[model samples]
Target chain A: MNTPEPFLGATSHTPVRHHILSVLVENKAGVLARVAGLFARRGFNIYSLAVAPAETKARFSRITIVVDAESAPLEQIVEQLDKLVNVVAISDIAPKDALERELLLATIKTDVDNRTSLLDVVGNYGAAIVDVDAGSVTLMLAGTPAACDELERELESYTTLELHRTGRVALPRLGKAAVAADPD
Target chain B: MGGLFLYLTKRIIVQLTGAQALIKSLEMEGVEVIFGLPGGAILPVYDPLIDSSVRHVLVRHEQGAGHMAEGYALATGRPGVAMVTSGPGATNIVTPIGNAHMDSTPLVVITGQVSSAAIGTDAFQECDITGITMGITKHNFLVKSAHEIPRAVAAAFHIATTGRPGPVLVDVPKDIAQSMMEWWYPASIEELDLPGYHPVVDLDADRVAQAIELIRVAERPVLYVGGGTLKSHASAQLLAFAERTGMPVVTTLMARGAFPDSHAQHLGMPGMHGMYAAVTAIQKCDLLISLGARFDDRVTGKIPAFAPHAKVIHVDIDKAEFNKVRRADVAIRSNVAAVLEAWDANQASPQNLEVWWKEINAWRETYPLVYDEPAVEGLLRPQHVIESIAKAAAPGTIVTSGVGQHQMWASQFWKFEEPGTWINSGGAGTMGFGVPAAIGAKAGRPDRVVWCIDGDGCFQMTAQELVTARSEGIPIKVAILNNAYLGMVRQWQEMFYDERYSEVYLSPDLPDYVKWAESMGCVGLRATNIEEMHAAIATANTINDVPVVIDFRTDSSEKVFPMVAAGASNDDIMVHPLQREQS
Candidate 1:
């Protein structure tokens, strides 16, 4: 934390890394705001954050936060979160042993000339057209973060009227994913 | 779990308002005292508090109330509590909240809110208090309904006093406080199962064995203890560990009383203003067993050079502290006391550290903290005044300090004889902390002598609280090192910024401190020379019935010595500004 801030775009010497952390916290109101306030105050970059009840009882909530690790060290981020009383536990869900997904919605300008091309390009990325208009098409896609990024890039050539992503949600591969190691 | 189930099944819930429920919950938690101020939004909570046994000490300002609660927490190993109204009151206490957060003090702060309906309407005295306090608090809650009071109060106390203790807040809106609800004394609050709130209370055996092994083989080892030892009440354990192993222990400013400062193996505070030998010891140590010490920037002048040669075994309750500033060879996440109890190691004798001790003693002899008579006649030396107070302070004196040169001087000069004897806003470096905190400490420990070592700049910040002490008959003695400047900042400007003292000087006409103390209905005296200082101290010592204040006009130009310039490595420590060439 005492180290100087690195440049925005990480150089090869310090390549940007995506760190997915599964945080378990008390299912209480305003907890989300408290967690978000911490990140805002400390300037810890959050790529995406998703929260929901972890169990049927609704006593606890699981927050999957995808952090941009080029900003702060992973252990420091985890330690800061651990200081929050509502936060119960935080685990790094290694990408290799985790299931990660994000939802993307894009409202595109689809005129008579590019409507077919837009639909064909969306089909190539396994996305569904949720709404359609004579001059616009709203498409929704749920897939790996990379896949969603790829689909967004693919549709860039066409006029993208608007776009929104649900960030990333992830769960660790449980029951001893054979080649996993826990930190000491 | 079974008790909670039984409590739920058999308990008879009675209707009560939020305010009444809050009082009952606090009583259930064995809260014996409260320091607070009443305001429009918090008036409802005060109504029921009258009927309760909890003694409430009305303070002049919310900041005083907050620091008082912090002092109470430090004195008693229990959570200190504060109550204030919303908006201005909530904002006023932010300093103390930040102070507690930094020093790891346990406190539960309750603020009165505007009516539930008026919350977001920008009604009179309404502020987003919970939102404003989120960054400084461990956790906070805004009770929207009367029914949430019991659960919220339970959770507040639970979270505030547990783990790496910090301040937790519960904001009760005026309507919610007035509204009626079914209430039962929660018998199961201790068993309240909030998932993911687990605090590590035990050490891993392997890590313990590994630490013991490191301690055994190390030729030049140092025990770096911090506030956690005192926070966890592991001071005795630390003393035992140091004694059993015969290792020299250096306590940080926050950990002043954790180990007896007079102990044979004790090295004074290690930091920018620490003893030369202590700082050098860290730089040269081979195995650094850091017990509950976070390598704070102040403690570690230059990160990479801090204990560079040492292999560290960092133990703390907050695992986030691991490698936060300095890397550790072995990290143990457990309560310091519990780990100390579980850890076992081979016995060590001084014979083993014969050479290491020789080196340490040589450094101590070579770099002794020294101050010659001030070149100007009649100009009192700050260090001389502090040392005199240290000489006069009785056993079990609880010393509180406001940040600046005085704070470092008090830490350096005072010989803490026991744990829970030194209380200051260490991590937050708060000014105006001394006066109110001393009053709070005196209130908590009436039998012991409480002293406030304050700087002139710091004393002016919360000096109004002296009125509270006078009215309440909290007889705390204050020793003001009246150096007419923000001494620490002036020193920095002198050393680093070429002495263009920028706004660091306080007006010489800032009211005679003696008259100011007398105006607050306290005995006041002024000391100009060493003889006058001793005489004034003696006079103050006899008059314990009322608060005493002594204004010792110390030299404005005297700077704290053995300072490692900010952002400079520890090895580059300098005793004087002109000697930077050798440094």
Candidate 2:
């Protein structure tokens, strides 16, 4: 019998960087479940996913998926998603090539002494105080996902009551030259 | 003037209930037959089915309906349609749906759902079938309104039949089926707003040229054909390509009839339980030109050792298939037929293959498929029984087999000369697929002969479908290789687990299959010896008015040979003991 060699093709690989996939799909019922079900059954891991109506809200929905490339090949993920009937288009956005943002909302307990300091911290991060209760204050931050992560880390010192983050949503960044070329 | 205008408009306008519209859509799509069973949720749809041109074969079980549709699709090269009620009916058919999905058979399965008001209430007989089948089906639709019926049916048929064909499910709620709507049908697939489903049929010029260049230079090339060739109707193209290039061809289980077994350039099947010459040639070949065949684990045993020395050029319609398993040197996304047609084989130059052919012919001679006579008298070998049936059957007979050692024997012993003649559950390996699939094949092609080669274990799973065949007057022949054991599992236990047979032995005489057939209103025959088996097959062929069941009491000691043990390298193929001793 011939000695078997280690087969290094598509099957053998090292985990690469996480990929940001922007998928456009028909705004139809169960479309999100279809996409999620595909990832679950195929053993593809999703780092984070966000879906909402696209620019054409009446017809299409845009889904931003942060995929753990370590679990499955990106090509396979895209191809499988493309096979879904509701999916319209898919674009893989490199971190540098895209603008990504996440909305973070947190309600934190505040006393008389810490209230002034908390307001200062919120203002420094460009966060707005949405609601102010006697013992707590609700702060909202809409910024880059990295910025939100940093803010969350800094706020760990405070007593946070409730927190919610609308996972990251992204779109390809406009080229510098294209932006400059625009007449407006 | 107002009265006249109103009267003319009223005469021109026509409205139809969703059920009527669904049936009308099927008729417009030229659907000849449907394999289905009706229930409360689907009762409304059945009312219109009675007045429609389409014929509905009432199946004994929903699972039978699904397999029949698959069999019909495999034989006729068209999308087979099956309809069932909700909940249990939907769940039962999931197996066949998965089977069709894996094999890429075109099928449209329709199921009735509870009323829209009762969808999420966990109402009686209400199941989330669309959600359940979303992963298995190629695509699925849940119609919310009555007007969507025609469009949904059109889309289901279109998606199921196009690209890499697969099963598509359409779940219609009871209320929607009873609601009224304006009747309309999409004139063509283009009219349907399916912007997401543009299958890549056009070949890329650069890739095609690169593939041909590799084929031209390779010293030893093998055409690895799969089920996609049959789906795309590329058998003629495949034959021409193989002949022009002087390359040997090996057909996968799903592709048995895609290439003629009689051809000189053809090597038999490859992989586990594959022919010795075919498996060895693939392992040693310099170029593996894969045509529409996925590198399935069964075909590529121990992927690291499979076609170790070969540079692969994989062509398939589904882009997802490329690089999903084995990386292709040249991956072309297009219909197999289109790719074959694009590669003008007539322009190919002849190359030297004398050494390759010499080695392959030697292997073929040394490890030829053979079986010894039964050690015990009056017991027939299953392989011999399959061979006997193949010999007695007509040229264009469609053969289906249930999953087991018998399925492998049918694949090995039968000689398939035309495309779409061999139908079996290849990828899913679903048991009880044979009888229903044979009935479906016979129903689809009334003029042709259909035979189901089954194992006793598999036969018992869905033998009830014989009643459906008898009642419908679709005569299909079934030959049960009664080994009284789960033959393949037993073989595995014997070889791998040291013969600790666990729940494998199904008593031979329990619920005797011959009597079981007779009880189902069909002719039943039994054959204990080789001569009797042959005579039984001949007798079954003569009687075409009703389904015939032949219980061939085959030897349980016989095991399929040329097997590369599960997860073992294809290089270590074990041939039959008799062949090994002779060699």
DockQ of each: 0.50, 0.35
lDDT of 2: 0.89
Q: What is the C-alpha lDDT of each candidate?
A: 0.84, 0.89
Residues B1-583, candidate 2: write the lDDT tens digits: 9999888777454699999999998998899999999998999999999888899999999999999999999999989999999999999999999999999999999999999999999999999999999999999999989888888999999999988999999999999999999877887877777877886555788898888888778898889999889989999988887787778999999999999999988889998999999999999999998888999999999998889999999999888888898889999888788888788643653377888899999988888888886435767989888888988889899999999999999999999999979999999999999999999999999999999999999999999999999999999999999989999999999999999999999987897888889999999999988678778988999999999999999889889998999899999999999877665
Off by over 4 Å in 1: A1-16, A53-57, A172-184, B1-13, B189-193, B344-351, B374-376, B576-583
Off by over 4 Å in 2: A1-16, A176-184, B1-11, B374-376, B581-583
Report the poorest 10 consecutive residues by lDDT, candidate 2 chain B.
B344-353
Rate residue B368 of model 2 by lDDT: 83
Best by lDDT: 2
Local error of candidate 2 at residue B253 (angstroms)? 0.3
